[model samples]
Target: MTTVTTRTVTYQADALTMVGHLALPAGSDRRPAVLIGPEGVGLSDVERRRAEALAELGYVALAFDLHGGRYLSDPEEMLARCMPLLADPDRMRGIGHAALDVLRAEPRADLDRVAAIGYGTGGAIALELGRDGVNLRAIGTVNGLTTGRPGEAARIRCPVWAGVGSEDPIMPPAQRQAFTAELQAAGVDWRLAVYGGALHAFHHPPVDHTALPGVGYHPRHAQRAWRDIVGLLAECLPVAE
Candidate 1:
């Protein structure tokens, strides 16, 4: 039988009090850990549930906050905060580090066996963490194909798996090309998965907030991406039997 326990964790990052969702597997033994980054809208039930799912699989999971315990439902509001944050790699790294510290402090977490997976703005933050040279077993992102400062990707010490909707306007072909080029030049072990006929934010469920053009959910692609992310972890940061 499998059991999962969960809790709320509050921490400080980027001058804001962040409330994160933490989930642990059934066993008392230290296990592989995963850091989950939410979309620009911030931490919501959507991400919280993902953490719980990971916990069911025997991985310590934490879904970190981005907007001080608030979920930004308005598109303009979300972009206002995320645009600047995304442009500043240091700030993104700071957010990632703060959450990582919280996860590492957990008794159930195996600090050395950890991965970072995120979506949208959260995905950008995860990539920033890897680029900042944080040791990670794997780095995965969905719909957040962001490029960092020149040569910064060389600091990444793990394999990277990025998924994007082929029709995503926000992360168009040029953007994806630039991001991939950086990883290629840095000689990082990176892979990209493009889901055909999908739009930006396709992995997310339909939001209750004001909708953004070119943003909608693709249920099939979403499940496929999740499988790929799980596959990445299994290959790089597998849980012990």
Candidate 2:
């Protein structure tokens, strides 16, 4: 196994103090970097493990926070915080740019080669970063196909990939169509993967606590989505030896 180092990082986004986890491979040379966004519920061990796994693959990865360092397990609280934030693309871009600043500051990150991938609310932030013309190599999101202003999406310079469950009530067929239409109208290179019989947050594992309705875990689909995300990174931001 490759040697990997992990650390907790704290940074600021406007007035908000954001905390994130950074993972780096055992190498002095700059490598491709990945910015990971957590779900609306906030950052969790799942995202940290994802960063670790990316480090193992030789990429510098940062699992960024959503609500400072708080993880909202209560469904109502999560919605209260996320819904309004989602409605405002500028706020989402601010959060993503702050985390991107931290990731790019890392010694191991290759600033010119970076990707953004996120889950749920985190996914929306990733998309916002791309829409804001952040010059990402690629963008990937799961259960985060939120559409933005068409003019802004035209600024996205990289390919975009998104995954969602067919049964996801939150991102139903209509919403998915709108997302795709926006991307297409903006001329962005994009792809969407729909997993059958999976619900919202299907990529997440079963937690000890209950979540909102229409959200559950689908182990098989989760693994498959991870493979697809890795494939996107490999295609767009391959690490150099």
Candidate 3:
């Protein structure tokens, strides 16, 4: 049986109190820490489950809330709250750094082998963190965009893996191609995995109609994505002897 423990950590961002949940493996000793950013809607049960699963894999996982304690089910409202952060990449980077600070404050987390994983808007934040040279061992994204300031490549210090749906309309083929070219030109160690027949938010097993437009949950893709994430983390953050 797998055991997981959850705790609340308080941190300040711009003088405002932000709360996050730290999930830990039952017997994990000095394991790497993973910071999990929720989707536009907020830290839902699904996101918590993802963090718990990571903890079960013997990593300290921190699921931070960028939206305080509020969550909206309506897609419009979710976008209203999330669009500002996406449009202003600098602000998004600040939020990612804030979450990293929270993770570093945890006693069980091994700050040296840190990684950030996100979905959609959250995914963009993960990419931003890596691009900004946050000392991340690795970064992973699920159906996230990669466009941002150009100079970020110089600051990137870790490998990145992005998973996207081949049919994802949000991140169209042309944009993906451009993004890939940019990463290549920047010489960032990165991998892009496109899942055919899968749509946006493929890793989210349940369709959130209120928060997503024309979304369909694919269990197989989600499972595969989960495995890929674990494998990537293992590769990037090898277990300490």
Candidate 4:
């Protein structure tokens, strides 16, 4: 892996001070950037490691935060915060844009060559950014197959890739169907990969806290999804050789 640097970046979104993890490649050249969003439980070392991993691959990565820098391990507490946040697209867009601004402001970031990738609630924010027409090079999400408002998917200008678990009750077959239908009708280039026998949040590593129902980790699928995301970035926003 290439040398990389890591830091904490504080920003405001949804009336909360978000403390995001920023990772930079070991170079002075302008580089493509990626935004990493965490699950509903909020930003943890899990996402921080992902950002550093992307940095090792020579891309600027910002693992944006939710819940003002707190990790809500309590399922009830997380839903209490995320349910309302999810219901308001504007709020989610606000958070996404706020993080995007942070990434773009970094001198090393190539503004035109940026992508958004996230998991769970964070995945939903990534999709929201695409729907908001943010000029992203590509969008990738795991367990974040959230359908957008009618006609909004048409605004997305880049290809979208999503991964889900076949047995995820939270995002069952019907939800996947509806999400794909919206994208298809909008004519957006999109693809979905369902990992058989996997559950929701399959991309996430095992957590120290109790997970919600239908939420569990699948190591094999997690590695596969990461590879697929790397492939997506390679095709759409490859780093300079």
Q: What would the TM-scores of all predictions be? A: 0.98, 0.98, 0.93, 0.98
Q: Write the per-residue lDDT of candidate 2 for residues 48-129, one digit (tens) a residue.
A: 9999999999999999998989888888888898999999999999999999999999998999999999999999999999
lDDT of 1 by residue, 98-135 (tens): 99999999999998899999999999999999999999
RMSD of 1: 1.0
What lDDT would candidate 4 get against the real structure? 0.94
lDDT measured at residue 177 in model 4 versus the true structure, 0 to 100 = 100
Candidate 4 accuracy as TM-score:
0.98
RMSD values for the candidates in order, in angstroms, are: 1.0, 1.1, 1.8, 0.9
At residue 42, give the lDDT of candidate 1.
Answer: 92
Per-residue accuracy of model 3 over 1-241 as CA lDDT, tens digit each: 6789998777765335667778888874788999888777777778788888888888888887777666666788888877777888787888888889878877888878899989887888898888877899988888776676876776778888888888888788987987777788888898999988888877776745424654667788888888888888999987563
Winner on lDDT (1 vs 3): 1
Candidate 1 collision pairs: none
Model 3 residue 36 lDDT score: 87
Q: Once model 3 is optimally superposed onto the true structure by TM-score, how far is the C-alpha of residue 88 displaced, in angstroms?
A: 1.1
Backbone clash pairs for candidate 3 read: none
Winner of 2 and 3 under lDDT: 2
Residue 29's lDDT within candidate 4 is: 94
